[model samples]
Target: MGEPAPLAVAYDEGAVSPAEIAVGVAGLAPVAFVLPHSPHVRKLRPVLSRLGRVVQLTGRPERDAVLLRRLAPAGVLTFSESLLRVTAGLARTLGLPHHTPEVAEVLTDKYRQRERLAAAGVDTVRCRPVPDVAAWEAALSAVGLPAVVKPVHGQGSRGTFAVHDRADADRVRSRLFDGPEDTWVVEELLRGRPSGPFGDYVSVETATGPDGTEVLAVTGKHPLTPPFRETGQFWPAALPHEDREAVSDLAVRAVTALGVTTGVCHTEVKLTPGGPRIIEVNGRLGGHLNELSRRACGVDLVRVAALLALGAPPPPAPAPPGRVYFQFNGLAPVRPGRLRALTGGDEIRRLEGITGHRPYVRPGDDLPGGVGSVFMDLLTGDAPDHPAMVELLDRALPLLRYEFTDGATTWVESPRRAC
Candidate 1:
């Protein structure tokens, strides 16, 4: 075979950073990276050392394009939505494929995505903008109570709220949108626990082509709470025969449902005993979970995604039974106050099943963002099994700590004990 294409990966300097991916081989193709100046450089740089580095936002004209030019990568890969949006036009001009900026904007906005899906007759929540009293009132009537009032365009599930009553709806909307004619989406909350009902969940970890989309792996999600914000995923889910088939089928349909081509996707769905209902579709890799799948199942989604961006064929997918256990150290709530200190960190290094561990906040740091459990994938691995993996991850929970105080309040939404 001729030389394979070199690839460029967008290195995120922020949370859930892709810094933890292990570069097992130079087998697929040589790789290069476009990196943001990151606070976690000491921890992150080692992960990308094998790849070429291109500094971004360096005050150079068309700096990203200039960097991409230097790397001369055969294909481009990016994790930051900001990076994607900022460089999309140039990438397109150079005929580098990616989720289009238009698609990115659409995917970012639940309301916009609903419009596209609705036209396709896809069954997602009915969505609308709710900026003020009148609009919120009208949207509630349209979407009904128990609506999901979140930013129309948002990430990390930040500022997401399931509004079950007028009081909460009014309050959250007022706080989030907070202006006349400001936009937000009120949607009929599609409630489905990812794994419990189906005994497994489906996420389409794949790339799209003009002719049809390819499903790289139809991995299953382990049981998690509603909205599944923090629960870690276990690869090769302990699912029954038919449920696995159903997840695959639904993912294919959802991709068709989105009219995508040559892009990465993370579609969340619940397979109720009744049937499958898609929670939402994301136009990106499924975060650290994707990295975990790579370690456990031996698939390189980032590599495949990069190749697909160049219209190149991806390497054959990895077979299962590779490793039965993959888990995130589940999400945990940080106690408020400037991080006075963190304890039990050695626990992460010592754990048997723990393949990866990352700390987004450290001692002497301030907790500045809104609260949610999963800021990044803190740990990953192939334990003997799901329950065993969970047991090991549970041990790392106490070693970490975050303290922050500004006389302002911050709330963390981990499972009860994680607090």
Candidate 2:
């Protein structure tokens, strides 16, 4: 009998769970998961163990490369931005299919990505890396007011903020610049559509391989809070056909410019009056996008990513008519406090079009307000239509509540925005 097809997934603790991809791949072929040993990953091991063998990853890329070489896996894939370079290095070491390590580096660093996009004639906002206060002032000046300041190598919007004026810039600098002279990028904020309900931004999900790139789906993003925290996301975003095409075109250009010969990517673009501008090109699928796309369209992006990793062609991205809208709402607290009590999970589950519900924090956990942090749980809803989806969330949100203790004050508070 022929030996089992060799495949391995380099795992990282990311915003979206890796279970879907791992589970989907396990069904197709025997797989191995390589990840760093940590308490958080330890808890996930048992659940992932059901899907495939789990291997402890040494922090060093060379060591991990040696291990992967021994496994002799035919393909390797990783979803974490932090691990992209390392994965590319290992893939190169194994003489497997992969974009060069330099390309991987370009994808993770926003400044490098913007540079490449500009060189390729793709529309991009003015951005520069600020390694110190001198460069920070210059970049902010060049970018102008209403600029975004973020770490050069950051994800999940951890050290990201919008600076409206000098005071805002000072605050952000003071907060983020204290870490041994870290690098940050300052860029002009891309203008969103004036009349759109939510700020006009969409992510193009694509699967690129030896054959070429395929546009899987375009997902829309909701308005963000201060510091650009995602409030919610829904699929089948109301966009004009031309605008969608424009975004897709730019995504293809950006991917090609960066020399991404193979793999899955999530490219974000914001529609401006002039045209569509590239927000950022992500090396892997966008967070919560895989689930949203699956419900909105009959396409499983996790499976697609896995197939691409194996140097196989995935099924064409289904263009199912938008019959239902799938939305993921961020359930985040408004202030810092200790979570005393929470409720409404049962009621929320009973609501119509409820596809999935999860609470990430437990009672007594400290709530730190940020992009992904402010929330203890995520609520996903599926509705027959967009308006109905909004209505369903309105009704379901009131039932869920959070009780927190700040200093001597204990109060029950609702999340920032309902689904």
Per-model lDDT: 0.60, 0.76
| Superposition error at 402 for model 2 (Å) | 1.5
Over 157-176, each residue of candidate 2 has an lDDT whose tens digit, in order, gives 67678888888888887776
TM values, all candidates: 0.78, 0.93
Candidate 2, RMSD to the unseen true structure: 2.3
Single out the weakest 10-residue window by summed lDDT for candidate 1.
Answer: 410-419
Worst ten-residue run, lDDT, model 2? 368-377
The per-prediction tally of clashing pairs is 10, 1
Error in Å for residue 328 of model 1: 2.5
Q: For model 1, how many clashes?
A: 10
